[model samples]
Target: MGRGRGGEREREERKRREEEEREEEEEERREKEERREKEERREREKRERERRGGETGGEEEKRKREREKRRRDRRRGGEEEEREREEERRRDRRRDRRKREEEERQEERRKREREYKRRGERGEREEEREK
Candidate 1:
């Protein structure tokens, strides 16, 4: 109803329109930047492929196969190493068992020698008493 009130409403409407326009412009700028970046990435990849002597479908497949082969070779190498380690452990265990058996044999021989010495002494004492 009053001029002052109308003027205030008009100013608020203008501010709202300006904010919307700013937001739209910012959105357009962001979209353009994204498109440019995507194009640049494509160009870079194309150049790389060209530099590598034109990776056609056959070349790509060959490279893929080579990569797979390398991976298999590496896995095989790891398995071989694991097998070698297992073999070494087994050898150590066998050596320890052999050593223990040898020690037991030596102890048994000593016990037999002690028993023979005691029997010889007893026989000599018996012979002297009979004389």
Candidate 2:
């Protein structure tokens, strides 16, 4: 029983040491990840600066202004196109309304003609019967 106790104590000590080692390894991994992230951030910033002409100067300012102008022009062009489309739609609607009204008038005239012909036929039949 004494030997068993000693064995149990040794196993517990070993487990503790293993846990500490794992924690240290995890801390090291976190440190490395942080370092890598910082390096990557610096690189991205440097690239951005280079893309923006490496300095905030008159040239960069000019480019920014030109970009803004182009954006505004595009927006204006889009608005003009939308207005033209709306006008076309309005014209189409007016034309369609006129066409429908014309069709309705023609239909009414046809109905009146048909009614008149029917009455004339009935009158002729009555006259023949009287004769």
In order, what lDDT does every prediction score?
Answer: 0.72, 0.73
Q: For this target, which candidate reaches the highest TM-score against the unseen true structure? A: 1
**Total residue pair clashes for candidate 2:** 0
C-alpha TM-scores of all predictions: 0.52, 0.48
Q: Model 1, 36-60: lDDT tens per residue? A: 9768966885786576555455767
For residue 92, model 1's alpha carbon misses the true position, in angstroms, by 0.9
Off by over 4 Å in 1: 1-57
TM-score result, candidate 2: 0.48
* Residue 6, model 1, lDDT: 59
- lDDT value for candidate 1? 0.72
What is residue 114's positional error in candidate 1, in angstroms?
Answer: 0.9
Task: Tell me model 2's lDDT, rounded to 2 decimals.
Answer: 0.73
